[model samples]
Target: MAFSEEFLSELRARADMESVASSYVTLKRRGRILTGLCPFHNEKTPSFTVYPETQSYYCFGCGNGGDVITFIKNIENLDYVEAVRLLAERVGLDVPQDSRYDAGLFERRRRMFEANRLAARYFFKALYSEAGQAGLAYYHERGLSDAIIRKFGLGFAPKGWENLRRYLNGEGFSDRELFEANLIRKSSRSDRESYYDAFSERVMFPILDLRGNVLAFSGRAITPDAQRKYVNTSDTLVYKKGENLFALNLARKSKAGSLILCEGNMDVVALHQAGFDNAVAGLGTALTEQQAALLSRYTSEVLLCYDNDEAGQKAIRRALSILEKTTLHVKVIRMQGGKDPDEIIKTHGPERFRALLQDAANDVEYRIMQARGAYDVSTSDGKTAFLTDACKVLADLQSPVELDVYASRLAEETGVEKAAILAQAGQLRKTVSRKRERDRLRDARAAAAPAQKAIDAVNPERAKRLRAARAEETLLASIMHNPDIFSQIKGEIEPDDFVTAFNARVFAAVGACMQQYGHFSLSMLEGDFTPAESSAVAAILAQIPNLADTLQECRDCIRVMREEKGKVGRGEACSLSDSDFLKLFKP
Candidate 1:
């Protein structure tokens, strides 16, 4: 769906690329670009560069680049319309609606949101009522305070098949609406009247979005004899799994500028009640890429506050793999004298938990500690193996100074020779660099294969086509980097003149977006391009030279393209055009 140009323009003007990017990435000013770690992928070096002058960003490491809107779309895992709406909300403006989606779509989402909110209030009230006594006792046994319980919108699902179903239905919600909102469900019995409350005899936790909308709920069993341990809201029109963090609604407001990621909702709740409101938890057993991106949008760092159990430690390793893909600085919080943050808080009080947060180990330190935990460092063979693995890890460090520091530390910790470890690390770096070069070359060759199979059976015709494609790509890159070049060439070339269909389509999108916004914006074209096309566009823009160099190359490319087109056309190859660009390129 298309948004109004005026609204999009205003949105762009308000959401500065640098400022929006800085919200997720720690950007350092570097000449015309703000260089930072790419939030789209893992990289020790800062390959993600934001060009504020053009209101765009490009990541050399991952080739995920676009304008501010596109950045927000991908970073937040939102659709184009949703991304625009979010930005508009940020600037206190309303987005103009499009009719492509049914008008009731918004109404359905609103009703679902309202239903969940009302259900939460109903459940919360019940927690204090006689029907909620069991749930209240459970919370008390777990030592949950009144304030903390209310803060999370925690409630109790009264025992019975239709307690919540009846409660919400009386509040003007139909049974079908209740089911759609995940508040009620049908039984396995084949009878048509088999409806029952989705959650029964459980302590309920309302999961809210960052905007404080009650999108869903999670119910923990209060009775041991309950058939299930935990029951959560199924996906609904308004809620999605692996998307919203349990406590991000409150944690996003924290001034810590960092987040504490835990494995369970109770851990997050406990940490928040202990005065660390910056805590959030992964929804499932492991952290997801979507969750990581969401956290990056709010804070620049994450403290992994998973439990100390084997599963929890394993989850931490998995989480690190995902978190590194974002710009957030990661640290591990190992709870001592307890199993998880909740237990730690209860056993040692809030001060010890605060101390743990302060003393969290950086990812690198955690990795080395993990390596040491794997074997007896005192043994000669174990030390050798540890040094070998440690050096391999150290080899991948982007900084030579970091390599030296870690290498020395490894030597001291393992009683190995510092020079020997350094030598091994150097060799490992060479191997890794060579492998990366091979992988890059492989990727280039793969990208070179035509997206749409244009006839390339013969070598000469294929070569001609490849050259033409290059010229088309170069010219498109020029316009993408410099909007002034767009009008200069718009009247001269057709999309058909481009050899590749994908590039032609992207070129068309660029022109359309530039015309609509009265400016060049990569994000404006993002809605139409596929992921591969977006990556291709990013690769083209990431390697752009200076404007003078780009203009010269663009001219050469245009000439080559025109020459190739002439070869396949009825016109004379020697015919000269009256266009000013042709005259300018006459020399």
Candidate 2:
């Protein structure tokens, strides 16, 4: 009961690349093609191009190229099936339910998701129940209202190991499910398995995914003397610490042009309660590339709302590196007279916090201010060092306008001439460019040397076959890219008809795509093929010279391979003849 090729074809047919891509990017008509900035990565100029005739898109800047399904998969951060389902839902189509899916694995994952959902509900109920009086009083003291508490699914884990264990068991859930879900830990002293709640005597905030499914939870201790201030669920099948952002389920729905990224659950909850519903927090971990990609999907801008402390400043720098790779416009929110966002809101109210967000400086300007605060700029040596360091930071700015403005600011702060700072910035830019060029050349040489070695080691007979196989791979990839070629050469070729295993897989995948989608596309074959096959196909497509002229080239290569086989059968040394070699090199 594997997914039928016909169902996939229908799904692909229903998914319009132009329509799906336009939802995330501002696509402009460009003579039978469409152009837009790549939503996958940051760029001031548009390098993401879509060809409606081919139903494919390729980002020249980042090298992320694929068809409609690939676009949805990357943009939505979903797996192949999930992306297919999402697009299917969008277009009012049904995903064929196949019986081949592992029922046990699916049920176990569902139970885990269900266990978390029920536990969150129970925790919320406990906060309002008579047994949660202490927790309720703690929230009241902190000025949190019922609305805020309920909005965040604020819950109290009663102070006992068996409370949740007994409750879930009484509700007919097996003990194994609880243990597997990581909701309870077993006691090490007694071999007898007992359920110990993961979070106890703490306020809980349910962490959700972009789809609004509860993936995990984070709990903060109410007791002042509590040894652990915060406890988060260990990574489970559904939750990866580096991949999820707290409250993104709600934030992505906001009309706010940017996201306010905070450091803690309370900070995110507080900001949301204060009408900044676009705020989200990382899972008490450094921001990651995966998380940055997730943020880039909802909005093109982000404000790093870390605590106003030394450690917080360090986290901002780390976040900057990750965010730099994405399309999100980034700025750092620097709080004054408060240690964190929650405190800032509590002490001065939402208006003050909003003002801070509005007045927040760009990362470089913020770093300059931080540097000025860290060192005394009154001395000539200190001022010179500060200006030099600040200029280097400004040079990293992607925009020329931003760099120029920040350079002028650096000059003003250090009482240095703008021309001097600009000169230094130009020098740094040249150095960076030279380093990049050198690295590129080094990589090219490294790659070419290996292929050269492979060619050198191969005997004439094997080398001829390998070259022929390579040509066939390129032909198959091109046919997959534009399947009209498939019909023209259908009778002459079959993937099983190829000799090499790698070539056979490529042809098989192309045949699969053509049979399924009526046209073969790289995106449609994403999860359908093995990684090695995908890489081989990509390499072939990328390296094949003059794709339009390669049809006859591939036919000639196959003919030469056949002729060599004939010579070997005649008890001769297998080699390409003059006429065969001429055909291969012919225009």
Candidate 3:
């Protein structure tokens, strides 16, 4: 729904920014602002700042800032209208809909949600039916309790090829919609009339968005000798594989401060049921940067508890690399006797698992320990190689205190002198630093003008006339910094007097904001902007800090802009040849 500026402003006024943010983040008041470790990224320090005066939040670490609606849209992955409605509902205010609101996109999303919900119901019903004996026995063998199974909405996709396809189509979904939902696929044959279910003879795990809507599914093969063990829904209108985590809807609500990063859906289920309610997993895939980023928003730290096997260890290494790139503190848990979490909990019980979580190795320590197995340090050559590679890893540590401790540990492990190891690490850091500088220089040298063009991408000749563009930007900023100046100069300058479509649009938006709110705010104008446009507008406004000479500045900008516009008009009318230029210079 499109809301009027007045209504959105009212919603912003009513919604509690701190309370809403605290629902997901643990915030502590700092002076007039409430501060928290940014949920948008991993950080040891509190960089997610909430300004109560404006009722908005900004993360200094991630550069994510906006009002309450923008916060909900980002954190919950909802659309703008959905986010507005969420905040409206939270404050017990009805969302005022504007006639300009187009419900097509929202309608399509709702249809997909309905399809998935009905499909999940059918699958759940089938799981308890006679046809689901194989799936039922498989879960029974895995020792999954009926309560947890049903709670997680575990189900069985039947062995019959068309079971789901026929059922969903009969329930009023078109074949194209079913295909779009990724529930079924058209036949490989020339005749498109025949279609088959995407998953069969597998245990179904419904993947939900934060709002508890079934957006997709992950299916684990129940067939004893199946070629691939698991299959997941491809990207659909409602789901993006890399952007979601299984059980996060429930997990984010946990009072636990940290989350357990497991590998599979069953493992996540096992962890959650074992009194670790903060466990979440990627939907049948390795941890992705998107998922890692999403996790950073909900928890301050992540404990990676992948399986004990080599594959799990490799996954842990890959996940750590990605997670470390974020601001989150990372830890690792290597299962003592089981291949995965489900097995570990089954064999060792919840208490033992909790103990393992408590004693989980810090990521850096775990990396160094893992490095030990990659190289044998008994021989002199092997010792040198181990120290060199180990120091290389240690050099990436951001904290000097951490580097010192790890360097000493590396020296002790390889029987090398601590001084020598530190020296080697220092050299390695220098070498890495030089290489990065070279890479940056190379990129700079090879770079052309930005491929991302504005509405008006100007050539060199056109750029010369963009002197007015700067003037236009300054005029906009002057108005932005002080709104009363806008009315003073309203009759003096026309919108078309602004050169460059980018600036002209910004000027128009400012005019509209003034008319509606009787004032201007950069944040209020964010709705009508693309990220690129927003950045451009912000850059322009930031360049002029003082509005001390608004009247003079505005008059000067208007005068310069008119001169530039006159130049463009004259230049367009008369094209001078090179000979004409040479004749003019001849005395």
- Candidate-wise lDDT, in order: 0.78, 0.73, 0.77
lDDT (tens digit, per residue) of candidate 1 on 379-443: 88888777787877887788889988998898887777899999998999999999978977875
- Against the true structure, whose TM-score is highest? 3
Error of 2 at 471 (Å): 0.9
How should the candidates be ordered by lDDT, best one leading? Answer: 1, 3, 2
Task: Give the candidate number with the greatest lDDT.
Answer: 1
lDDT of 3: 0.77
Please give, for residues 166-238, the per-residue lDDT of candidate 3 as tens digits: 8988989988788888899888887547678988999999998877899999999987898888888999878
Among residues 3 or more apart in sequence or in different chains, the pairs in candidate 1 whose N, CA or C atoms overlap within 3 Å are: none
What's the CA RMSD for each of the models? 7.5, 6.5, 5.5
TM-score against native, each model: 0.76, 0.82, 0.83
Q: What is the lDDT of residue 401 in candidate 2?
A: 93
Worst 10 residues of 1 by lDDT: 451-460
Looking at model 2, residue 513 earns an lDDT score of 60
